[model samples]
Target: MKRILRLLYYMRRYWWQALASVFLMAAVGLLDAFRVLLVQPIFDHVLHPGSPSQIISLYKIPGTHYQFTLQQFVPHFIHNVWAVVAFTLVVSTLLKSVCDYAGTYLVNYAGFGMITDLRDDLYEAVLRRSLSFFQKHATGTLLSTLINDIERVQYAMSSVLSEFLQQFFTLIFTIGVVVHFGGKLSWALLIFVPVVIGSIRRIGRDVRQTTRRGQDRLAEIQNILHETITGNRIVKAFNMEFWELLRFRDAAKRLFKANLRSVRAQAISSPLMDSIGAIAIALLLLVGRGQIQRGAMTEGAFFGFIVALFKLYDPVRRFATFYNNFQQALGASSTIFTFMDDQDDLVEKHRAFTLKGFQKSIRIEDVGFAYRDDEGEKNVLHNINLEIRCGEVVALVGPSGAGKSTLVNLIPRFFDVTSGRILIDGHDLRDVSTRSLRDQIGKVTQETILFNDTVRNNIAYGQPDVPIQRVQDAARAALAHDFIMRLPEGYDTLIGEKGFRLSGGERQRLAIARALVKDAPILILDEATSALDTESESLVQAALSNLMAGRTVVVIAHRLSTVRRATRIAVMEQGHITAIGSHEELMQQSPIYQKLYQLQFMDVQELPEPVMMGKSGL
Candidate 1:
């Protein structure tokens, strides 16, 4: 019930439309009751051709306690019975049709409006979540929540609101008319009321539970589809198409069974309600005949009473169905609300200082870090200390899992250090706003992250309105201008997904151009050239050199030749900095550095001579 109320809270913005719809639906119910009452006059007066007293009695105001007749309200000269009945039926039917159309339109207007507002707000909340949140949740499951779950909720809200209003008013009006005519005979309906209510409650509970499980199964199917389609290349390379198909089939089968269970539960309510209603009708008829024969009821009134009683059950049955649908919507709402209420792990401080630009140097002091895992916290880096002055290129080199990438990631505060602090210029990274801190840094990774956009837009991604001439100049410096001009539409051509239309070297060059256009004071290149072929590597390496001209650069590379030109080399091993010096200095003084260098170059082939020798006599 709380979740349902929360869903209704979204309707506050559209209250006027809801109110109008309710009033119109109430009018519709009054018209329906009048239609049933007309049957009494048609049977007793128009069809029977009764005497004047009998006809006048049938025209009495429709209530047990009220005795005034329509003849008292109209002149006898204009009160021809056939003309009055014909005119009343035609006008009432026409008015009811208009009210029905207007009422349905208003309700749907409010429903669709609420859905639009909810979807926009939910999407904005998703965007505000941290990187770690996305790491934990699957893309397909989130998509299912945003698209599928919200769609289900929309159907439920619209259907339930429309039917609930119409049926509630109809039930009230019909019950009033039944009691006015049938009196004691109407009490027979009380027996079936509890039965209907109890059955609806039980069926609704089962449907809600089964529907939640079905939605979960549907999410799993979406996850599989997302994975297989996005990673189709890998699937084909490994020849696992048949395997993926079988997995999809299994997930789909589970979803089918779950939906069947939910459907079976939801479908049971109508027939059960109808059967119970039939029994109540039988009891009413048996008692109604006795009242008619005893002259306690008019034959016209008795037949009208039967019609109103049966019509009352229509709304009752609809209410039961509405309950079933409302339960399904509640299941979907639970998933959506849970995600919206989740707190982000990375929260910025209030009124945090903003960094304008880089100054002297960056200092890493007594840093330690760990990544959370299923077993427990696993340490990734410990007791790391380093100082990088402005305009110096410091190359971080080591074996896999040596924490080179993790150490550099600390500067950007991607994940905060578990122990010590890092300072840029003089301000602690944590003390400054993340947007301001990141604005001063640019990064290019081995896997180039390019959007499916034109060359002009991709190069000027961060600053979309950057001048065309500046974009071209940045591309020229990155050596991408030449190939870009050879394309069909030059800079206006659309690059396919992730720039797959371009070759490896072209894609890396475009990534470099993007960073060059941003022109931040600090840069980090993580294995940027390692994936390309020989020729592509030379082109990309030259572009990297130009990009690193005067920035404080942190280059993490496994290739020995790539880092040879750095101002200094820092050798890391097992989460600690083992040595830091010039490449030649480290080669002679540090055995760990020497072992790595020898393994890569194999006896210093195509390299400079040794500048010094250590006690180890390398």
Candidate 2:
């Protein structure tokens, strides 16, 4: 409830629209009630002037001498009555058209405006969430919230305004008509109201529960759909099309069953209420007949009583329908509110600490961390101590699972370290605003995730407002400028999704170009050139050398050549640095480094001994 209230708070500025909708709905409902009340005037003033046979013609058809019957009376009459009926019909038709148009305009117009804003706000919330937040909720589930959940609440909003306002007004207006017709008979319904309302409340509760289950099922379907689309390659590679289809079918079936149950209950409610209302109508008719027999009220009065009875129940039926909608609305709104109610993962300090310029260095003192899982056990990176001074270049090298990426990730506080403090230029990284801290570093990783945008857009992404000449220079250093110029659209050529259209080398170079453009002081290169072929690697290596000339660079290298260029190589094993020295020093002192060097070093220039007289070194 609080969640929805906050959503409503955003809509406060649109109150004029909501106010107008309510006004239109109330006006329309009362006008409908007035139309129903017109029956009394027709019965008394037009139809029952005297005996039925005493009715006279109001117009003349000279050619055929045709006469309109009672069914087509008033406007069709062959007398003065024709003129009055025609005028009355024209006026009533106009009011009905105007009221219907205004009601439609206000209700739908406002519902769309409110929910569209709601979707944007919901998306904004998602974007503001941390990367870990995305890991916890799949694209499908989040997408379901954006689409299905919001749509469900939209109907709830429309129903709330339309049904609640219209029915309440109609009920009041009908009560007046009923009491005017016959207060005693209308009072009889007072006793019956409690039973009907009690039954409605019971049914409404079940409808809400079922509606919630239906939405949950929809989320599953959404999640499965997202998985299949994104993992379509894997599905095809594994020949699991049938399995994927089955998974989606299962999710769809669950949603179908849930919706069928909910809608069945909702469908039965109205007809059941209508049947009961018919019995009540029959009771009113009988009571009215008795009054007519006793000469207490005339036949016209009895007729009017029944007419008023129908009018009262019309609003009652609508109110019951509104209750059904309210139940489903509550079910949908609960999820939306829950999403809106979440506290942001990163809590910002009330006052941000501002730093003037970079001076000293980055320090990781006795730093340790673990990937915290749901089960509360921390995986270990212990007794870690490392430092990177200004203008220094260090390389981190180890086997596959050595936590090279994770260690660097902590520098930017992408994930806060589990049990250590990282200081940047003498200030704790946490104390510095994440934005300000990140602004001081640049990164280029192996898997270059590029958007489907122009080459200019991708290169200048890190610094969008950078001048064109600077962007061009960075591209030239990346060796991407010549190729980009050769493309059909030059720098404006659109890269396909994830840069799929570009060769592996081209994509890697683009990423380097982006990093170079930012020109941040502290740079982390995570196997940045791993995917490039020998030719591309050679070209990128030159570009990278230029890019790393003066920056405080930390390179996480797997290949031997990349590491040899680092000023200092930190040999990491099991998440801790085992040896820290230049390539020559490490090759002499580090045993692990010697083992790796021996394993890859060129064997004897020409077979050390004479190969068994023949076969040589075949």
Best by TM-score: 1
* Tens-digit per-residue lDDT, 1-618, candidate 1: 789788889999989988999999998898888777777777778777864654444334545666755444344565787677777677778988898888888888898888888888888878877666787789888999999889888988786778788788889988888987787788777877788889999999998999999999999999999999879999999999999999999999999999999999998999998888888888888988999999988887888898898789899888878898888889988889888888876678899889889989999999998877678888999899999999999999887789998898788777788898899988888888999999999998868889999999999997988999999999999999999999999999999888989998999999999999999999988975346777888888889888999898998966666668789898999999999999889988989888777665343365667579888988
Compare the candidates by lDDT and give the number of the best one. Answer: 1
Model 1: lowest-lDDT 10 consecutive positions: 53-62
Q: List, residue by residue over 1-618, the lDDT tens digit for candidate 2.
A: 565476567567678877786777677666666555556546654675554443333223557878543334344444544345445556666775686677766766677778888878788888777666676777877887888888877886764655577677777876776776675767888877986898789888888899889888988998898788877889999999999999888888899999999998788788878987898998888888888788886666667678778877877776667877777777877877666666755665767676565667999988887764578756556767888998888888776677777788888777767777889989987788878888888898867889999999999995678888998999998888988888889888998888888888888889989998988888888875345667987887887887888899888876667778788888777888788898899888999777656553324343245546556745
Clashing pairs in 2: 57-78, 57-79, 58-78, 58-79, 58-80, 59-78, 59-79
TM-scores of the models, in the order given: 0.89, 0.85
Backbone clashes per model, in order? 0, 7
Count of backbone collisions in candidate 2: 7
Which ranges of candidate 1 are over 4 A from the true structure? 51-78, 598-618
Evaluate residue 310 in candidate 1 and report its C-alpha lDDT on the 0 to 100 scale: 78
- The 0-to-1 C-alpha lDDT of every candidate, in the order given, reads 0.85, 0.76
